[model samples]
Target: MNPRGTRLLAGRSLLVLFMAATAVPFLSLFTTALAPQGSTPHGISWPSHPHWHNFVDAFNAADLLPLLYSSCLIVLGVVPICLALCAAAGYGLAVLGFPGARLVFGLLLLGLTVPIESLITPLYYQMQSLGLLNTRWALILPLIGLFMPFGVFWMRTFFQSLPKELLEAASVDGAGPWAAFRRVHLPLAAPAVSSLAILLFLWTWNQFILSIAMIDDPSKRTAAGALGAFQGHYGTNVVLLSAGALLIMLPTIAVFVVFQRHFVKALLQGAVKG
Candidate 1:
């Protein structure tokens, strides 16, 4: 076999290994969740009598309904606003060639280095000062701010990869900057926007720390945040805890499964452009 064929075989084998590695934990969780309640199941053994009711019990015990609603509310509030702001900022920085854009972009890039853990205390105080604590706004507002750096960067990179002639062509046809952005670039950016939306949704949904720090009520907290309290209450019950975990994970998994095509397409587009 040639060197290229050998490398292909090796890569395929590694990919299979990685897929299995990623799947094992979730497979274990599923089997444990199905095991008899209050019973400790080892490894990934199938239960002789699956306790499917564990899921229902876990849902009720964790009060997941309200938590799910809160998560959806936060996601709805964050993703669209973040996308709009990022897209506009990206367009200005990458395409408009405005003065001092480099300095502004560099400042925003610094935000990517600041850890969320470090901001929690300051954010808590800020939210309190604004009287937004314990409300959905506590999560919604901070998340938008926190997500800006990476979101802007993502959209900026995509915009920068496009040919500048596109905008010039739009200008030749009597379109102004806003018109060019709205009619030309925005349409071309659909894949990038869709991909960014998926990422924002996942990040917002799985935001555990901010959700826990900002909101006192478990019901108002994001699904991932509520898991801490749920585990605290049901920590001893491995079966029920597993069930609740799977329930918390369901939304993210469902979302990825639904929009995975867009995510993959965006990634492929980036690779090809690069």
Candidate 2:
């Protein structure tokens, strides 16, 4: 084979190996979840009789409805507001070029480096001072703040990559920044925004530390957050736990599968153009 063919074969082999490695754990989880209730799953072994109802049992046992509701509530609360604010911030930073903009952008960059673990303690205190702790507001408010840096960064990078001609054309037509954004840039930004929305949805759904730490009530916490307590209560039942874990993960997996093309396009376009 030629050198190019050899390299292509090597790349394909690597991709197959990578895909297999990633699929193993999920395959194991699915098999284990099908194991009989109360039976300990030993590795990836299939059960003699698969019990698909373990998911139902897990759902009922964990009282997952409230957890799901709380997760949805938080996601609904966080994603839109965060997206809007981030889009506006990104546009201002990338297009407007106001005074002190670099300083402000620098602070946003600094936010990306700060670890969540470090912020939790101070955030807890701050929330307590505001009498917001133990409520859904506790989760919603802190999460918005936590997500801002990355969200702003993502949108700003995309905005920077956008062609200036679109904005200029809008201006020549006597359009202001707001009108230009609404009419021209916003439509073009669909892919980038969708990508950001998917990420925010995934992160918000899986947010455990903040949900558990900020909210005292397990029912009020996110699905992933409430899973800790659910696990504690059902720690002995591996099958149920496995089923419940998969159930918790279903939404994120579904979202990714649905929007994967857009997600990939956004990443590639951002890397190439931004």
Best by TM-score: 1
**Tens-digit lDDT string for candidate 1 (18-41):** 999999999999999999887989
Q: Taking the tens digit of each residue's C-alpha lDDT, what string does model 2 give over 1-274? A: 9999999999999999999999999989999999988788777888888898999999999999988998999999999999999988988898887999899999999999999999999999999999998999999998999999988888888888988888899999999999988888778778888899999999999999988899999999999999999989999988899999999999999999999999898888772255
* Predicted structure 2, TM vs. truth: 0.96
Candidates in order: C-alpha RMSD to true structure = 1.2, 1.3
Against the reference, the lDDT scores of all candidates come to 0.93, 0.91
Which parts of model 1 are misplaced by more than 4 Å? 271-274
Query: TM-score, each model?
Result: 0.97, 0.96
Q: Model 2's lDDT to the true fold?
A: 0.91
lDDT of 1 at 111: 99
Candidate 1: minimum summed lDDT over ten consecutive residues — where?
265-274
